[model samples]
Target: MKTTSQSRMRMVPTITNETIIALIGLYCLAVVMGYGRFLFTATLPDIMTQLTLSTTVAGWLASVNYIGYFIGALIAMFVPQRTTWQTLMLWTAMSVITTMMLAIPSLPIMLWYLVRLLAGIASGIAMILSSTLVIQSFSLERRALLSTLHYAGIGVGISASAILTWWLLSLDYHFDVIWLIAGLSSLPLLWLLLGIRPDNAADANPQPRSIHQTYINFKRSLYEAISGNGKAISLLSTSYVLAGFGYITSTTFLPVMATNQLADTYAGLQIWLVVGVSIIIFNPVWGILAKRIGEINTLIGLTLLQALGMFSPLWFAGALGLYANAIIVGMTFAGMVSMTLNIIKNMNPVYSNLLIGLATLAYALGQFIGPLVTVALAGDNDNFDAGLLAAGIGLLMGLGLLLWFRQLPQKSV
Candidate 1:
């Protein structure tokens, strides 16, 4: 009886290394991507009011950050696979420093720009490296479902920041204080991250190679990876660019938009919270749906859905439309990211890191363009309607590309 009981107990699944890694990834993302990146979006209205900044200035700041992210993704593409873990730790520390710097008061605009730019670079590197580590680990273990948990960190971080902001505002806390508190909150997570080592030999010494040789090798590998599936890859990359452009305006400005429309500060935060919660709930659903309907088809359906969400505020009245938009956009954006990366990784597992970096580079360029174009279209009155419309159109264009991609030979994808 004892032997049978022990055998049954052994059969029960327990916490595995991949699961622990996934959880660590979740927290790392919550800090780097969530608090480090989106905290600005959550606190933007307060920052603008406190700093006496114009909409155009705010748009410029956002664009500058995306430019930094673009540069970071470019750098990540060239990062040696053997060094990804160590490099990720370095960038994550940078994220913490930049987040804390935002707490400084009365800084010049140039300083603000520099800080945000640095933060963006940190975010981009942390995002790519963390995802690369978590997904590759899970894929090796044949536990792909864990990737959803890893991605869920973004939503968790967003939700946590929104909640913190909402509470602080109720207490009449200044934007600087909010920044400080957010920064300090990440310390525990960072400590936890430090204690957990990646499965990779992150401390391994690298073989000396000339920069020129490294670049040549990278170029050759990238070329070889894309050569067989050039058409499909191109379509996917173009669509991802559109996805980045289409979603960012909403990601960056939704809280502000809601506050403007509702004339209630808390209402906007609530809406942002809704977005976070929706992401947490639905991101996993997307993975399961992809299994049932095929990833390409799932991408098509979600792209169309998000485009509709982008247009909802224009069609519907008041906060109702904003809420609808929040839920739909929130649910789909993270899923789109994970799904797109997963597809590319599966395309060539040997070069997944390079593929992911390339995709991120494309996405960051679109992000860099989004705010500038939106602000330009919005003009002096700060009317975002036209910009929102443009974002929807971009998503539709991306949807068209996905459709084209789907029509390509299945073996190529």
Candidate 2:
């Protein structure tokens, strides 16, 4: 017979443990993604002004970062054993250091490019590790909800940085000051990592695979994914590539585009703030909707919404279009990411993490291509309308693929 005191103590530790895990995952994303990844967008205009960057060169910088992201994803897929929470901590710390390095006023353009590229790699690893470990912490009954909380960290980080950027800019702070502040703010998250017990998760199954077995398994999965009913899954994976291209174009350039169109430096940051808010608010809702309507259908609907979001700036003018773009795109993108991962996991539970890394690799490749196309089309005018149009078309093509996928026999994926 258990006393009430013992029961209370047990309950308290369990709840405390759960909360701590969620917080670690959330702040890891906030530091790695919000600061490391999207911070470039918030600071790009300033970097361009200070460095005298041409549109073409800016595109190159973005591409190089995504290239690092691709390499990180590849490593995560092939060598998942390295993705411990300690590794996540190491990468998160590196992101802070590299982000601050960009504040060096005398840093060459090439150095800026290199630092951002390294930051991207750290961000990519942190993103994969945080999502993987956080999801594994919850049981199947609670996994979807917990997954929503985990990914929502990206939005939280984005919103916090956007607000901070806006506030600092209003006070006439230099971009370097902004970077320093961002770096310092991440220091507290490090303490949370101290409490992380990777083996404490309810579902922590560290399956060790030899390199030879991993290679053979990879080959077998690849062959199956490309043949027979697996063809639908293959096609689905391909759609993620286009999704990456479509989303990254707007994400990379939204602030620059907004500033130019509105003739207000802060307008873009404000819109980005809206986007962050929408992502935080809607991701959990999207998770619920996925459970209700089915992941495939939810993905199709979200993709269609995102396509329209990409085209909104081109379709309408003034604040109406900008806000619509932020809200629609913000609400859909993170949800689509979560749903796609869920679909992939359901398709292959045994190899889900590797498959996710594979899907992310495809997406990273598309991201690598996106900025080059945008810059190429923008030329000297700096007008991004044509680039945005191309992104919309790419998303529509992905939507078409999803429609075709829907018609296929639902037996496999």
Candidate 3:
């Protein structure tokens, strides 16, 4: 009986190191992207109410966070490869600290700006580092699937944030307490992160390089890639910018929109929750679909779908429109990101780092501008109809660029 049991156990497959690394990446994203970054979105309506903040001020606050994110991403692009793990840990710690700071009561608006900005920076650096860690650890054959799993962390984090917000609201906890609990909740994950050492062989004896050298190399590679695939790369980057602008308006204000339209806080929160759930459930499906179709096709389709989702609220009414918007947008946004980066990387595998870095910067700029533009379009009445329409138009323009790029002849890098 013992021999038989041993044999059965041997037949079962054990989890691989790549799987462990992917899980670690997921946790990192969940905490940083989901809680540290997006918790603001989930709690924005309440914060606005409690602080009596104007729509313009609220938009500025959100834009400040993205500005920090943009700077952090730019910083990450030049960070020495050898220090990625340490940098990730440092940023993760910062993320935790900054999140907790949001709990301080009656903080000055400038302080609020400073805290959110720091949190955004932390989230941005952690995001880039964690993604790099996961991708480098896995082999090409398994990369796509593992990456999908890693990206699922965004959805997991978003969903968890939404749920926690909903629960706290139900318990009549103020936004401060919610932020406190959210910070405290991440402590365990931080502890777990310490145990996740890099198993990649390259990490064993990494060569040191100065940030200046790294930047020069990256700049040189980027120039070569653009020189070779100028039109394709330009179109893709511009599309990504529009995508960043297109999705963020809804991402930031969906809950607030829900509360306004439905007049029910719980229902408003539920819409965000549904988005998280949809992202978690459908993100992997896109990876599978990409295998059957192609990355470009998948990306174009996603962009089109997202554009339609952006326009849905204008056409549909009440909770129905909000839910539709949430589900559709959630389903495509993350996939769009993964696909775009993948496409660019495939264009010039040697220069992929710089290519992806450039794409990310463009996306970040769009996100930084998105809320400010949306709020400006929203005007004194705080009506988002015009903003939503503009967002959809941006997506459509992006889609058109993608189609044009698709028609271009493929060139080997």
Task: Give TM-scores for every candidate, taking all chains together and pairing residue i with residue i.
Answer: 0.93, 0.88, 0.90
- Identify the runs in model 1 with alpha carbons over 4 angstroms from their true place: 1-16, 139-142, 199-203
**What digit string (tens of lDDT, one per residue) describes model 1 on residues 1-413?**
75684455455343347778788889899988888888888998888898888889998889888888888888888787788877888889899888889888787889999999998899888888888876776754444578888999999988998999999999999778887998888887655555444434434558889989988998998997787888888999999999999999888888888888897758878988988999899988988888789888888888999999999999997898899999998899888888888888779877777888888888998898999988999888888888889999999999999998999888999
Who is ahead in lDDT, 1 or 3?
1
| Colliding residue pairs in candidate 1 | none
Better of 2 and 3 by TM-score: 3
Candidate 1 is scored at a TM of 0.93
Candidate maximizing lDDT: 1
Q: Model 1, residue 273: displacement in angstroms?
A: 0.8
Name the lDDT of candidate 2.
Answer: 0.79
262-362: candidate 2 lDDT, tens digit per residue: 86769879888888889899998988987798888999999999999988988898777778888987898788888887777666555555667777887
| Poorly placed runs, candidate 2 (over 4 Å) | 1-16, 81-83, 200-229
